[model samples]
Target: MSGPSLYNHFRTKDEILEAVADSVSALVDLSMFEDARDWRTALHEWAVSYRAALRDHPNIVPVLARGPGRRPAALRLADAVYGAMVEAGWPPAQATSVGALMRYFIMGSALGSFAGGFVDDASAYDPADYPHLGQAHLLAEQQEKIDERAFEAGLTALLDGLALQYEQARATT
Candidate 1:
C-alpha cells in the first residue's frame, strides 16, 4: 500500500508500527497454554511459540519491543501470558516483571544474529592477542548449532530463575 493509503488507515507511523506488531503477535499460538499443567509449563510453551513468531518476522522484533500500543492482539497475548504466570502462583508484580523479562529476551534473540555475525576465520583471532577466542574459527561452521544451544541455555536459565521465584513466593505465603 502507498504511504497515503496507509495513513488513511493508520493515523501515524507509530500507528502503523503498532499494527505491524499486532500482526506479528497474531502469529503466535497462545492456545498452546490452554491445557498447560502449570504456569512454568504454560509460559515455556508460550515463550517458545512467541520466539517462533518473532523468528518468522525478525523485522518486527524492534517494533514489538517498543511495547504494545493499544493493539488488541498484542494486548491479548500479553494478558494471557501474564495471567498464566499469576495463576501459576507468582505475585502480580513478579509475574509482570517476568513477562517483561521474557519479552526482552525473545526480542533480543530475534534482533541479534548470535552466530551469523561472528568472524569465523582463524586468522581473525591471533592466538597471542585473542587466546580465549580460539574457537572463533569454528563459529561459521557451527553457527546454527551454536545459536540454538545459546538460545536454549538462556531460555532455561531465565525459566529456572523464575521457577525459584515462584517457589519462594509460595513459601512466603
Candidate 2:
C-alpha cells in the first residue's frame, strides 16, 4: 500500500489527515453522552472512552489534536460534548471550554506522555543529583499505570472544578 495505491485513496496530505482524524474519532465512545444522568458522569465516561480509543491509535493523535475542522465525525464529537454540557446546564461558554479542555486532556494524553518520556535506565537518576527522583527510573516501566493514574487525576480535578462552577452559576441564576 505504498506510493500510488495509497495516493489513489488520498490524493492530498490534507485529505489523508482528515481521513485519519475521522477514522480515529469514530473509535471514541460518544454513546456515553447519551444515557448518563449527569453531565459529569457522561463527560467522565466519554473522556475515558476517548482516551482509550486514542491510546490504541496514538499515531493519529496529532491529527486529532487539530480542532474539529470540517470532518463529520470530529464535528459530531465536538457537538455532542458541547451539546451535552449545555443540556446539562452549563453556560454556552463553559460548555465550549469543557469541550476544549477535555480535548487537551485526552489528546495530550494520547500524544507522547510525561511518564513515557523517561528513559528506562535504573541509573538515569543519580541519588545525589536527583534526590527526589529516586524512583523516577521506574517511571518508564510503569508508564501505563502512571499515565492512567495521571489521566484519572486530571479528569477528576477538571470535573470537580466544573461542578463547583456549575453550582455557583446555578445559585446565582
lDDT, candidate 1, 82-139, per-residue tens: 8877877788998899889998988888887777886768888899999898887778
Please name the candidate that would achieve the greatest lDDT relative to the true structure. 2
What lDDT tens digits, residue by residue, belong to model 2 across residues 1-173?
77667788888988988898898888888886787568989999999999998999888888888788899998999999999999988889988988998899888888877887888786988989988988877788888998899989999998999889999978887
Overlapping backbone residue pairs in candidate 2 total: 0
Clashes of each: 0, 0
156 Cα displacement, candidate 2 (Å): 0.6
Weakest lDDT window of 10 consecutive positions for candidate 1:
32-41
Provide the overall lDDT of each model, using Cα atoms, as 2-decimal numbers: 0.84, 0.87
Scored against the true structure, residue 156 in model 2 reaches a CA lDDT of 97
lDDT of 2 at 157: 96
